[model samples]
Target: MGCDGGTIPKRHELVKGPKKVEKVDKNAELAAKWKYCALSQEKLRRPIVACELGRLYNKDAVIEYLLDKSAERPNVEVVAHIRGMKDVKVLNLTDNPAWEGERRNAKGDCYEDMHCAMFICPVVGLEMNGKHKFCYLQTCGCVFSDRALREVKTEICHKCGDPFQDEDIVVLNGSKEELEKLQKTMEERRAKAKTGKKSKKSKGVETVSKPSEAKVSSESKPGLTNGESGGDSSSSDSVPGPSSSSKTAKPITAAGSKRSIQQMEEKSEAYKSLFTSHSSAKRTKDQLSNWVTHTPYHF
Candidate 1:
């Protein structure tokens, strides 16, 4: 198979092993179900995780801004204080309060509320300690900490790999026990694989990548792999004509560097001509008093 960006290490490559056709089929079924799981807006009554409790909107905003700035400089962790279980866990109402006041008040509109059970594990990552943690948020929302409040783009946290809630408060670090359990589950799965039996570990809604599916990820474009190295430049040349080259290749000529400026000047001249004609055509009908009314007067 062709490599994408980074070199595909030999270790990650799957060597010949006994095929677990049954498990593969099961995983395929699971993948299909996973696809369907994302299609609905309905909420299930699951365990109430403390992190899903209500959010303090301004606190979240400040935390997110700090996190973006803290990406370059390590060691800073955004920390927040948690009072009790209600603070940690929350019931995610299906009826999003954010959209509340948009329409006219109608009777019995049935804006239902549902809860998603989620929590923040306390285990810290290599870059920072466990002291700075935020509450659980929607997997798509932010988790605040000492460095900054970060939005959890994926279902899992980038650092600790914990599942966030739809509206859960999150701590930066997961509990040590939770990390140990995660590791133990992974180890158990590995061990069970040797015996040709499926592992009993909980799939607990964490996002795990399948090697086969990842090899053909639509999100990862054809020329690029999930790595830092640049993708194939030849594909960049195939678009309509030479335009893609300007988009893909590095700058080599002064003409290329000044192309945008030239385009802007041409656009500005066209706009000026249009405006001049437009004003001159209407100059006779326009009144001086209309413009003078808004002007500041000295006397």
Candidate 2:
């Protein structure tokens, strides 16, 4: 065949192949989870905090988000459940001894350690680089590897020596299954707390009701006794004959009657002296004649 205007096809160009699948780097993924804040995606610094779901965050970043949740943020969905500071616990991380933070970044230092860790497990000496499972105590905030805690098997904290229960231990950056289990446990604890409050309230109501009931019964008994005694006295007094009743009724009417003016004057000598009905001293006949003349005309 005659040669065409197009260039010759190479062996590699003629071969058809499937698109390559992009794979995430293990080291980079681990670094993102452990050394960076889950919410802000910044380098982890002091005053780091963790949520109940084991997501890590910077304390300042969380505070800023809480202050103005309506503000635009890069990863707002990551902290949608975080309402306030109570949802997060500040970590008390142990600094790694091998870390040379500022000195390693010096201009003169030729060799830099890429695998340096900022914090480590105090008991197992494991770097917190997402390779091993880690957990923190809610009571003390001390962190340790899961393996170390299982091996040691003590109720007291390895670093602070404070006593702790299984309920107090919270996993950091746990898997989905672990997070679900933690949520269930939290719900159960809250339910128990509510039940306890209800029981106390019921007990208080019972105590108050009992005293009031006793007072009502005691007061009712005295009223009944007084009523019975008064009724008995009234019945006994009513048993008299009609003649005796008439005689008693006549005296009651006489005692309650109003006195006449003549009877009142006869009862008291002081009242009789106020009027001239029985006066020993009388006006003279000449004084009466003068009183009649003085009334008609003045001299």
RMSD per prediction, one decimal? Answer: 31.2, 16.9
Number of the top candidate by TM-score? 2
Total clashing pairs in model 1: 39
Cα lDDT tens digits for candidate 2, 1-299: 42368768776677888889999998888889898999899999989998877888999999999999889999898898787887678888899989987677779758766567899999889998888899998878888999999999999999989999999889988888998998888678768978999999999999999999998875554344324657654764678778755643554455456665446745677765566653534677765664344364565
- Candidate 1 residue 26 Cα shift, in angstroms, is 8.4
* lDDT of model number 2: 0.82
